[model samples]
Target: MQDCRILITRPEPENTLSRERLHALGLASVPLPMLNIAPIKGPQEQAAIRAQIFDIDQFDYVIFVSKNAARLACDWLDACWPMLPVGVHWIGIGQGTTQTLLEEGVPALSNPGHTTEALLAWLKPAKMTNQKILIVRGAGGRPELGDKLAERGAKVSYLSLYERQKPIYTAQTFFMLPDVHLIWVTSGESLTNLTDYAEQHKPEWKCLPILTPSERVTLQAKEMGWVNARCAQGADDNSLIKATELHIGKQND
Candidate 1:
């Protein structure tokens, strides 16, 4: 029998996205969100973005780490910068990010494999010396992309557009998560939040399998007392579902 039940342990937007994917596959998915995404806005930050908007043309390349980043940057750019300069290449970290750019009418140069490693690998063979790279993302993200680009001779500028916060569980949120067969974790932050919740109510998640989007997330889940954690190669929805099915199949075998 297929494991018909699934638990999504991500932020709100991501939870809805994952649930839609599960629904497409004819599976039942429950949103047990652990993280919440909030836009970072302040007079100082707005001034910063406004000051930096005109300088975007100086950058040879721009990178968007997530859809939220892409949306926030593009929205701000449209309001301030009327014209997009030519020859500035746009790069997205993954399919979701790429789609976000496309939706916002921002054409990107490269849509490589998802993750910093793949994005950097795709850039390694290109001419990076003296290139300027602008990265739009959330706060507290890995600096691997910027660091790698800089090491490859590109000057990197980072723009923080939002922050990811651990959700303060309400009675409704608590009711949403209980006994379940599996939990899909897409990011380290989400996994950490899940672990924190599990610590308070270990029995709620003791036997559930933890499925992660990558090896890094798997390691984090394991560290958080999830012995049945496994990483899916592709971070896409289809890949995650296939990985979960295979893992469940293995258990049966």
Candidate 2:
């Protein structure tokens, strides 16, 4: 484990936390920050967010797609509405999001399996007819959640709180590509960015072992020509660490 080097492709700030955790576990981590998260900075977007916050009580359920979404949305909520509206059940896509919600003073339920499909399954038992759901996420993300909720007779609205941009490559980013034994991909976009960089700069690095947060991302990595792509249990830093250690243990065995 000490000799193992894992490349973390999550966005910065978060990547720093992941690297620190890995370092604590005696494993080396190389942060390559494939994605750059920026706040949506247009007047129209700000107005839209304000309007959504104004009408927050109209939604029956509020779903946060990621911890970033939860943090941003809660920041807005804290500013606009001093007291959170009652009777609206808050849902988080995973445990990390749930933790964020809790930290933001919002009670939320999280997906036990830490996947969109799992969240959809959990919601299937609820009476969704005519229910209003507010999804807080980045500008562009999977439409599956909204589509599925709409299919179940729920009205879904999106509040795009942030924008995800592909990071411009730097010397530091490229320097870690050759020494990485495993690439920890948190999202499909991150996986794509990593492979695109590898294809252009270091073709041999494309086949490195990639540990993804979900099977969908694993398949994406495989389709992108990564030879060894595996799914971790969840998208949290701890899950990535556990998956990396397990993979390393298996390789050593």
Candidate 3:
């Protein structure tokens, strides 16, 4: 929206592109990252991750649930495989993750929709009766996909590569956000963190409009006392921009 300052609550590196896109469209934004995507770095964890990478071929389908997962998986897989093992299907949850894998030399199938339920539907659980699926993701990622697959008699496993940690911010940072007209929250954890902080420090900010990635999350926002919560079409920048346009147009009406 023109001149409307939106708070981008994505982690660094990723938020950089979001801010750039918003600015290019004559929108103002403030970077207030809610979470940090940090790789799992302990010695035991590293070995476990390495072992998963080396044994990647055994999984009939390997799913990269996010761009973070794709990036780390490609890096680790590159170290282990001069060429990706044949007959192992690569899957990504969205365009961003699929594109990341493509750029990293892993041809992958992206889910037709942005949500786990959509991906599960696309995979056709009936046919997955005996498939081996590996979801490569950050720690504490959603287990819905794996659980559904397992319920269909498929063997499901995970290779957790990173953890989402809440970022530390001073009181001044929270105080500086009064002019932010909208907030874009990408994940459940981010929404919870933002809601918790707002409830404690800026209860009035609950009235500010906010954008989430899906209808489910938008409902979550409303339940958390957000007066004008909205959901973007998807988790991509294009979808977010379209949603913002629709919102501002409504105000102009």
lDDT of 1: 0.78
Cα shift from native, residue 28, model 1 (Å): 1.0
Backbone clashes under 3 angstroms, per model: 0, 0, 0
lDDT of 3 by residue, 145-205 (tens): 8899999999999999999999887778777765778789887788999998888878877
Task: Please list the C-alpha lDDT of all candidates, in the order they appear.
Answer: 0.78, 0.87, 0.87
> Per-candidate RMSD vs. true structure?
2.4, 1.5, 1.3
List residue ranges in candidate 3 displaced over 4 A: none
TM-score of 2: 0.95
Which is better, 1 or 3, measured by TM-score?
Answer: 3
Candidate 3, residue 10: lDDT: 87
Which digits, one per residue and each the tens of the lDDT, describe model 2 over residues 118-141? Answer: 899888645998999999999978
lDDT of 1 at 221: 79
The Cα error of candidate 3 at residue 55, in Å, is 0.7
